[model samples]
Target: MPSNVRHLTSAHGDASFEACVVPYLDAAYNLARWLAHDDADAQDVVQESMLRAFRYFHSFHGGDARVWLLAIVRNTFYSLRAKTASDAAHETIDEETHVLVDEQPSPEARALISVDIEALQTALENLPHPLREAIVLRELEECSYKEIAAITGQKIGTVMSRLARARERLKTELSHCSTEACRHDVR
Candidate 1:
């Protein structure tokens, strides 16, 4: 290729990635964090995915940028997962780790609604990876079933089935939480 052609191609790729892929960075990070289950790992996944996306930018035709980036993120997370199984097995836990502190506490304690975010997070974390991903993509990320199917490389029907199963499991788990909360309330 000629030098100017090469330069223009590189510029096009850079502009495409910045315009199409960069906007989804936060959403991509959120997906990565949920999939990887660690902030550092999630960050690594997002970075690697973005690099891969940029390298392959020519392959991307105009479409939903968020879904395309998320697809890349999902694949990267799985690749990382496969490579880190042994490391994950021997990982140590700290008591203070993973504690979510609300930075700006809501001043409205008028009704004291019991949502049990910790329980929900635990339930989501315990779900099988496919189910968890389906839920995260569909519910949390507000992706359509078709979008999720493309991102996850699954058939739309399969995505629907997984989401249904995930919701059922979440309901079962959240019911247990509610029961405990009810008992505590009555006491």
Candidate 2:
């Protein structure tokens, strides 16, 4: 690479990194947080993944940047987990941490008309990492089976199966939540 060519390439790489990787920060963090099961670890994983992605930005071809970034995030999380085996065993309890206690509604008051996003998020947080990641990639990120396969390094068939199972789990969980709420109403 010539001096000017190298400089131009550096600039282009920087621009591409910003345009492609920056937008996927939330998606990356969500995936990492689910997999790592700790806010700080998740943050660290995403930051490290961003740095690694930038360092190898030249390798990226034009495609879905979210999938590419997610793959990096997934790899980074697993690598760190493997390197720190015992450390990975300590799982943090996030249920009470993220739960919001709304002011109790009076019996005569109109029933709460809307489902809380935070509650739904907390429910998602409680899902196992594999199921959670599948749901996040397929439902939240709207990634196709092929893209998810690339990101997860799984075959398309496995991706499809995981996604189907994840959806079923979520539906079952949500249904239980709804039934509980209805039971509470009857009391």
Among these predictions, the greatest lDDT belongs to: 1
- For 25-110, candidate 1 gives per-residue lDDT tens digits of 88898888788777777778887887788778889998999999899999998998888766362122222454545545564431
Q: How high is the lDDT of residue 171 in model 2?
A: 76
Give candidate 1's TM-score.
0.80
Range of the 10 consecutive residues with the lowest summed lDDT in candidate 2: 1-10
Which runs of model 2 end up more than 4 angstroms from their true locations? 1-13, 87-119
- Cα lDDT tens digits, model 2, 133-164, are 87888877788889889998899998888888
The runs of at least 3 residues in candidate 1 whose Cα sits more than 4 Å from the true structure, single-residue gaps closed, are 1-13, 87-115
Top TM-score model:
1
Provide the TM-score for each candidate, comma-separated.
0.80, 0.72
